[model samples]
Target: MASRDEVECWLTDMDGVLVHENHALPGAAALLQQWQDQGKPFLVLTNNSIFTPRDLSARLRSSGLDVPEEFIWTSALATADFLKSQVPGGSAFVIGEAGITTALHEAGFIMTETDPDYVVVGETRNYSFEAITKAIRLIVNGARFIVTNPDATGPSADGPLPATGAIAALITKATGKEPYVVGKPNPMMFRSAMNRIGAHSENTAMIGDRMDTDIVAGIEAGLHTILVLTGISDQAEIERYPFRPDEILQGVHELVENDPFLAEIND
Candidate 1:
């Protein structure tokens, strides 16, 4: 594994590393500012593709963080790329937010409200019984299934909420069909993000909270991984997990403090 000093680009997960339930974790913003000031390259990679990079950028800035659309890479974007490979210019049934849908449309996939060539699932929004039935029928009628991520639930300021993976699971159970998932813990998303930045895993380090999806994916992608204890997976959980991170941090803000000049280093 390469040393932290050797890492040229850093990729981080947003929810656990930067905030919890909309509340900026201790030092999250400062850490981001610190990196920016130091000129340390970093990008925020997220599974939530409901919002466009621009939309998410505005939201992050509103929440007291300074982020730009260019610094964001979302699963929705990755899913769109995946769909492009599978069915370019083909019709699709997408169940997600504007970010995912807009990307799909831009990729030349037709978004249909009725029977379609393919069905894609992401974070659920206003899913009614009728919508479920329509999705089921389409799948039954030979529509291919594609899930953005398999996260069962996501962390929020309030607490945890059912994520798109949960909704995708419901559809899979109802239709007895499986969907191809493309998100963290899956190198497809990582590869896409790397491709976007033109950064190789050898020069990039993935810093995130969860071991399963975040760190595991980093390892599989041949990138260095750092486990942040700011969110889901705790210290004990890390010991039990098969994949291990190259380094551990309390949070993004703490990461800022870890600079040798900012904080004293000891043996």
Candidate 2:
């Protein structure tokens, strides 16, 4: 793997690396500004498919991170991109919020209930039983199943709530069919993000907090991977994974502190 200095493009997980619970982490804003000033190609990546890129960008802004909509990549967008490539202007029976719906619409996909080409599932707070029933029936009848991510649960103030993977599992139990997931842990997400920034894996770096999803996917995509302890995984957790990230740090603050480019700029 190439050293951090050799990297020309960067992809970082949003929740852990930059923000947590709607608040920007230490040095997150400065790091983004540094990248912008240096003309570095970078993107903020998320497995969450509940909100559109515009919505995510605004949320980041609220957290004091100035990431633009175009610089944010979600699993929703990657799913739409994958499906668009598979079947241009295809139709799907979708169970999701504006994120997945908007992406599919922009990709020329027709959203319908009857005899759709695929049954696409994404993240939503309101998972209707009726909608799930329709999805199950459609999948049982023959529509291909697709899920935005494999995350079984999402963090909430109360506790962990059912996510796309959990719903997908329910549908699978009823229909006996597994969904083709298109999010983190699947290198396709990174590849699509890299393609968006016109970055090659050899010259790209990925920053994430989780070993199972972010780090593993980065390694599979052939990009330099950095793991931060700000969210989810820590030193002990890192040892659990057979593979390891290229670098591990306390948080984004350390990343900004150690950056040679930022040092040169300060000098």
Candidate 3:
């Protein structure tokens, strides 16, 4: 692991590392407070674009981790930022949860349930034919395809379930179009986060539970990576995979406790 003094930013995973199942994971709050005490920067970053930053902040606060709205970032927001600069008027044919729509709308995009200039897909607990058909129509009519993260599934309290990939696959099958993803493993998404932290990739370390998206994305962006065993990835999975993380931790709490001689913090 890199020395603490060398660290500039700690990019984090929200669901697995900072929280689990709507509850704050043990050590998460303290670790965050530790960062705050040091006046160091961090973020609650996640591929699950199911809540707006304000909504997510409230959720986290209710769950016992009181963080500010600006401290939380999601794939939905990044996707919105990406589309704002690329797609004029930011009109979209979206197949995602309410958060995605909210971010798109907040970004001055005209969100539509039907005919659109782009088809942006994200996680939705309920997948339906009508939903797929709408996206299919957009793609067939030459609408640009964008996806919030390509995770094939999501983490359940038990594990993972059929995810955004499955939905994208259904849409792709219907229209023979593949969507451009704007989450982890996508450098643009990482760049967006770096922009938020005002840090360079060389000084940032992404801590997450998933290897394919989080770790891979960090590596691709030239950022250091830390994989924890608390979420989707396990020791067995790490051993089985060709990709490797720069460091590994059992969970978020262990991360803070393992650091040598906690530095005197300012904030």
Global lDDT for candidate 1?
0.83
lDDT winner: 2
TM-score of each: 0.89, 0.95, 0.88
**Cα lDDT tens digits for candidate 2, 1-267:** 758989889899999889989999887888898789889999999999999999999999999999889999999999999999999989999999999999999999999998999999999999999999999999999999999999999999999999999999999999999999999999999999999999999999999999999999999999999999999998889999899999998788767747654465559
Off by over 4 Å in 1: 34-41, 155-160, 257-267
lDDT of each: 0.83, 0.94, 0.82
Cα lDDT for residue 262, candidate 2: 47
Among all windows of 10 consecutive residues in model 2, the one with the lowest summed lDDT is: 257-266
Per-residue alpha-carbon lDDT of candidate 1 for residues 1-267, written as tens digits (9 for 90 to 100): 568878877788888787776667777688778778888677888998788989888877877888888888888889999888887788888778888898888889888966687888877556667767788889988999988888888766688888888888889998999998998879889888888777888889898898888988999999988888878888789988866899998666556755542354343
> Number of clashes in model 1?
2
- For candidate 3, which ten residues in a row score worst on lDDT? 258-267
The model with the greater lDDT, 1 or 2, is 2
